[model samples]
Target chain A: MKEKEQMKNKTGYIMLLIVLGLYGILYFVHAGKTLQALEATFGVFKTVAPILLVVFFLMAFLNTFIDEKSVAKHLGDDSGFKGWFIALFGGVLSHGPGYIWYPMLQELRKKGALDGLIVAFLYARSIKLPWLPLMISYFGLTFTVVLTFYVLVGAFVQGIFAGKIMNEAKKDR
Target chain B: MPRNVQRLKETSLQTFKTLQSIAPMLFAVMGLVGIFETFVTPEMIHKIFNAHAIHDMLLATTAGAVSVGQPFLSYIIGGELLDEGISMYAVTAFILSFVTLGIIQIPLEFSIFGARFTIVRNLLSFLFAIVIAYMTTLSTSFLSGYFS
Candidate 1:
């Protein structure tokens, strides 16, 4: 197990180095365009990255505070409506690029978040905040109402189905 | 209760350890993204999305698939789309996919969840992204009592 982890770490590091090296080359090759892009990207990171980092840290810290047993006690399979609602809301409320959220979601699953709930959250991410206003401005009240209702409903249905399928599949395993 | 304190301490330590383990890679990736950001341009993005309806949606999805950006970037691009007379559907598709999908991380996802599962999930997400955007537009139009 120790050797396996060491191997994974080495592979991860190599991948990181390769990616970094490529970016370095790109940055230098088209310094002018790259600088503009970098400024825009940095402009983006300045606002979003700090919030994401804080969330990541809080999640990491919180995950440790709640063991599988406790998570199971609160959010386990049979916890029913309340548990499901929490999972769904938690998933919807969480933010970040989907890539960044992947590891955290994996951690949540390990900590006993139901498969359906996880799926629901992933689905809910498709909904955006700024778009809500734009959506309201463009689409208006009735359509927005129905659409929001449909998304929330779809998220729940998808989550539950995903959970069921995974469990069933796991049983065969 | 005493047991709970011990568990809490153990969990805290584990959390710290995991963050410590991943911190280097995380910072490295963020730094790379910062570096890459310096290179993008509106014309570059415009070239990627163009103006054809079907092509624009495909381009939006494809762009959303490859790039990572904050919600603000989506709004900025969205405003540009409106100004440029790009279809609302296309812009919406791009925004939806931008946050929910990752084209560049397919390999990583494949490694973590097996290729078959990862591909199917993303394919499903991408398909649903269009639907969600369409619905958002349709609803927005209905609520405003005007075609948008």
Candidate 2:
């Protein structure tokens, strides 16, 4: 696991180095364009820095308070409406990179959490709480609100479809 | 230390770690975005998206599905795309699929979930992203008009 994490970090570093290297080469070939790109990059970082700080802090808070066991506990097969609620909101509140949650979700499925709810959880993750402010800042409140509403609706719809399809496949098997 | 204080400390440490881990990719994305801003013209983007709602949504969905990133990064990219005169439909679809549909994570998802489940979920997400994009933009415009 540690090796895998190290590999991931290495990949990120390599990608950064490549981008930086591109800029370095561009500096000799097209210094003006390279400077312009650097300025644009700085502009983007400046625009996002405050919001990113809030997002990071919120992520940390969520991490400290919400443990995987508790999330898993509510997503069981018989969890019903409450399970759906937990799945939807839990997805919104989920932090960190999405891949990290996959293993825990896989474990949850093994323990009998419905595939529908799992699908819902994954879909609802698109509506991230930490990033809501940033989204609102870009897209405005109305667009953000409407988009979030539809995303939750889409989550449930997709969840139902996945659940039904998986069940039918199981029966056929 | 008190329990609240201990929690705060842990949270702060986690925040630092997350920021550290994400920094490299974040800078890389920013640099790429800078290059995109400097070189990628509106004419180039328009050629791909073309402002026709359906066409833009489809292209946006395709672009977003193949792209991988954190949700926050999508907002930045989406915002920039919007600044470049990409339609709201395209940007919306792009943002949705960028987070929800992970073509890159297919192997991981397949290994964890069965093939049927992974395929079904991704296909559904891809379609729904377009639907939600249209719904979101239409609803926002309507609400804006009503309020005004």
Candidate 3:
């Protein structure tokens, strides 16, 4: 397992090198655009920094305080309706770049969280509480409410699909 | 050391390790995202939709999947498209996918979650974006008529 993880890290380094190589080539061909891209990259890092900090802190808290058995009880295979509800609402309440949550989700998965609940959480992020007012202003109350409702339902449906397929795949592996 | 302090130290070390493990992929993802965002503009997305309902929805969903942004930004873009006479189906799919899908972050997600899980989750999300968009449009219209 450690060897496999090391190999994955190596692949990530290779990918980073390839991106840097492309930027190096682009610098000569389109210096301005390459510079703009670099700036955007910095902006992304800046935006994600605080989110990453919070996520890491949460991970640490979970690691220190929360046991695997507890995680399994709440979000594992048999967690049922309550687990799904937590994931769906948790996704809605989560704020920031969705990618930032990947590591936290990974931690949960390691602790026995269900794939379906993870999918539910990710899909349910579509209904942003902070943006509902803005969405309503542009699309009106009916449209906003209906769209949000569908997104929640769609999330649940997709979660079920993910759970079934992922569990089967796990069994096969 | 006290028990609580020992736990705190362990937590900090664990956090650091996790950060170290994910750093390379995270940086690579950010680099790719920056390049994609710098090159792809909202106007470029706008030009892709031709106002054909089904065709536009597919294109919009594809566009949204490839591109990433905040939900608020998607709403603004969706509203602009709607005003420009794009079908509600197209705009809705675009908005839904824009938030739910992240093609740029695939590498990071793949590295963290493994290939099968990442692929399945993303595929499901992609399909659901279109389905929900269709449902949202139909339901919204019905609700609007009922309320009016």
Candidate 4:
């Protein structure tokens, strides 16, 4: 366990180093663009930071109030359509970078959450509820509605495919 | 009261640890997206979508799958593409791909989900984006035509 934790930290540091290296390269080669990029990064950070907070709070709440058994009961391998239907909403409500949700998902995995439901959640994330007004403004109401519906369907398809393929791969092992 | 406080501490600690674990990669990803944003202006994207040829759907979808941006921006871009006379297929595919696939964020995704799940999920998403885009255009236009 100690070794695995160390490995994870090592990977994280390496990735951070890579990002800093790229930033350095940008600074030297294209200083103006680099500044603009940094500015852009700041913009993203401003938007993402709050979402991250919410996600963390949600995770903590899950840990504190919700037990693993309940999670498994709802979204487990045998969770059926009801589980999947709830997962779509759960996923959409949870926002931020996909990585932000990884730890939570990892927790759920330990509790036996279905990979299919997870896939559906992530896929459906493309169409955020808050962003709908803007989407409708640009694509018109009809297109936005249709596309959102398709996205939901696509997420389901993705979940099913991931579940089947991952299951098969597991069996092969 | 003491027990509640202790539980709160543990929860906060766990959330902090989770954030610490992924913060590096997350920062790196944002930095990269920032740089990409500097070069890949919306104007450039606007110029790229007039191909309207037989393989335009693939072209649009591939482009969308590659480029990474916020969903809101993609919606606006989709609107611009429509104004530029780009076909609905390309526009829809582009928007779908833009939201669903992340060529730049693949490393982050791969790290979190592992190689097999990441690859399969992304590939399936790419294909589905195209299919959905086509279906979306067909349905919207077909419905209006039928109703009209």
Which one wins on DockQ?
Answer: 3
lDDT per residue as tens, model 3, A28-86? 99899989999999998998999899998899888888889999999997899999999
Q: What are the models' TM-scores?
A: 0.77, 0.64, 0.96, 0.92
Candidate 3, B1-148: lDDT as tens digits: 4986799788889788878888988898889888887778889989998888999999989999998656787888889999999999999999999998888888888888889988998888878888988998998898888889
Q: Rate the local accuracy (lDDT) of all candidates.
A: 0.65, 0.77, 0.89, 0.80
Q: Write the per-residue lDDT of candidate 1 for residues A42-152, one digit (tens) a residue.
A: 575576566666656676566646578877766678768877677667656766555556556667777887766666777776556545776566534565566567567
What does the lDDT read for residue B126 in candidate 4?
Answer: 83
Write down the C-alpha DockQ for each prediction: 0.35, 0.44, 0.77, 0.66
Q: State residue A80's C-alpha deviation in candidate 4, in Å.
A: 1.6
**Who wins the lDDT comparison?**
3
Score residue B6 of candidate 2 by CA lDDT.
90
Candidate 2 residues B92-130, lDDT tens each?
A: 998999888765456545544658988988998998998
Backbone clashes in model 3, listed as residue pairs: none
* Lowest summed lDDT window (length 10), candidate 1 chain A: A3-12
lDDT of 2 by residue, A32-107 (tens): 9999989987887786677566566655665566555654567765577899998898789876545546545654
Model 3 native-contact share: 0.78
Chain B TM-score by candidate, in order shown = 0.78, 0.66, 0.93, 0.86
